[model samples]
Target: MLDQTILSILKEQDQQLFDLVLREETRQHEQIRLIPSENYASPAVKAALATSFTNKYGEGYPGRRYYQGQVNTDALELMVIERAKALFGYPHANVQALSGAPANLGVYTAFLKPFEGKIMAMRLDHGGHLTHGSPVSVTGQWFEILSYGCNENDVLDYEEIRRQALEFKPDVLVCGYTAYPRLIDFEKFGEIAREVGAISLADVSHIAGLIAGGAHPSPWPHMDVVTFTTHKTLRGPRAAIILAKDADMMDRIDKAVFPGLQGGPHFNTIAAIGVALGEAASPAFKDYSHQVVANAKKLGEELKVRGHHVVSGGTENHLLLLDVRKSHKLPGKRVAVALEEVGIVLNFNTVPNASDRQKPLFPDGIRLGTPSITTRGMKETDMVRLASLIDRTINNLKTGKISEGESAWKDDDEAVTIAAAVRELATSFPTFAW
Candidate 1:
């Protein structure tokens, strides 16, 4: 458990901030958190964030530091790097990136000159993340981007992706995704990148834990560069790590992360990441990873049986996109709001082939996953019950029982009934502390 001494001190110094923190903690304990990218860090990982290392400024790599007081910082960073490399089987690891976007930007800086190279990546709506090639991101702003999309059935068309890579001959070919539920074919991606004379980069930010625990295939020995966030599924602090197979590429990435992109590394977060990597390398975490997938499969199956349109028919991993507009005649945003009123948390997402008539602010799909719930120790049977609750909530919304708008649902009788039942169920399966 976390040491409550600091929290007690904070409560005495700033009652208002302490109250807000308590309320947020209560909300987390009471809600069914289905967000795919979210998880509860273990007590050790949390404690590492509050350590004395946070006060130091570690500007460079171990043994090559620009600062004087880095003896302890260097030891912590080297442990983190070695743990990450051992877990992922990578030859080199850089643990200084603040988050996923910076890690990706570092890769670009190491390999390609600004405006002198091109990138081929998956389309955003089809499952790619914003950093991949979205026009709104710095990556798209600085480089020429060619994007490929999934087929009508919501599966990656590798043949078409290969064709695009061959035609464009981009400087880099990137794979992996944010909302994709199926296993990625990293071998094919590497083959295409090789044929086109482009570097292959796999952004396995969402599935890093699964890879570490042997629940999913790894991109190693095939991909030249890989990036992942420690917080999502990995259940660590909010930081990112980059790994590479070649020594030259590793040196380039290290320089890019230090002087090219960011300054001093956050030693506190790096220590927390080391704690998470240690946990991930354990046998227990492997069981947790397998159970996460099993719970997701059961939840998707139950939702499909209830007549919901699960994108791509079902999920093979941690998340599934529920197309509420197609089956329930309700906007995804509307359904998401109603679920939240009942203490079921998820986000509205854009499904493949979403029509322009459906506004971007209110897309046609809701993305739900089993990571957080699985972390709470819920299993397949629990997933069935939760799916039933979700079905009842949506049915009430489709009818006139729960009001159509977001705010009006709070006062409706059916919504209140559902919320009470949700609270009861949530209390039964208390979240784990460590």
Candidate 2:
């Protein structure tokens, strides 16, 4: 939350933007946000974002900056880099990539030529990110892409992955995801990349906080290069990090990020990243991370018990993908919208194609997680309650109490009752309890 003084400044300078921020804050306080990629940065992290460091521009690495007034910026960034390396157990790191996409591009530029290099990655529809060579991104347009996907049951088929790796011999083996809800076998990915002589890069944007808190396994010791965003599970600022196993790899990625992709770093964000790293290093954060997974698993279990079609059967991480088409006989967008009206917020997504042929838009699946709610100090019992609300919302939709389209479920007695229940549950905790 912004301090009163900062809110006053915002209100004075830009009333419209301030109002939007206020409305959003109110909405967050009233809704159960389940978007896996979204979380509330701690007050310290948010405060760091509003610092005077935002005024400076440090154009290069610590010692060799292109700007003159970089003493403070350099120290802050260097400290953040060291924190990242230490926390992630890596030898070298570049904390300058603007965000995850540019971070991955930095890695690509470090090793691959524009048209000649091949990147082997998980298919986008199967949980891969855009920067991992989805056809819509620059990563796919310039470079050759070989994609692997889950099996008939929406599970990763590692044997098929190995077969593809042997067949393609890609320059980079990419193993990370946006929506896959199971634990990644980083060791197996490492073996495949090593056997194929490809550089291994893991993007842990979704679970960097979990890895930091030891809820999930680290990608290092298995990956040659690793990239992650600070804002996601890490509960930091909106920036990204690239870690390399050795100096040679580090040098290439650093040069690629500095002189190749990005310009001056966001110093405020770097400072906040340091703050978040310090916070994440605490014992409480470890407990919060474990609870995040517990909540997700319990949520999946509850949903499954209610006869929901949970993708991959269940989750081992902080997220669950549901085929709403199977359960409610409704499109995921309809369910997502209807649920949001009831104060439970999540996103519609593409389930693995095994169950249905769904595209990115109007997909039949919904993706949600427990990170934000867990950060708000929610637990398994709360997840059970949420599942019940979700079931009620779906049932309401079926009976025409919940409206479709870009409309809220207002003007109905039952809808109002469910919404009141949601608000009661949502307002019970502070925005960032953990």
* CA lDDT for candidate 2: 0.89
Estimate, for each residue in 53-95, the C-alpha lDDT of model 2 and write its tens digit.
9999878888898889877887898899889889999999988
Give, for candidate 2, the lowest lDDT window spanning 10 residues: 399-408
Q: Model 2 off-target regions past 4 Å?
A: 354-357, 399-411
Give the range where candidate 1 is weakest over 10 consecutive residues by summed lDDT.
399-408
- Model 1 off-target regions past 4 Å? 398-411
* CA lDDT scores, all candidates in order: 0.89, 0.89
TM-score result, candidate 1:
0.96
Deviation (Å) of 386 in candidate 1: 0.6
Residue 195 accuracy (lDDT) in model 1: 95
Structural similarity to truth (TM-score) of each candidate: 0.96, 0.96
Per-residue lDDT of candidate 1, residues 211-300 (tens digit): 998888999888999999999889899999999989999999999999999999999999999999999999989998898899999999
Number of the top-ranking candidate, with lDDT as the measure: 2
Residue 356 local lDDT, model 2: 52
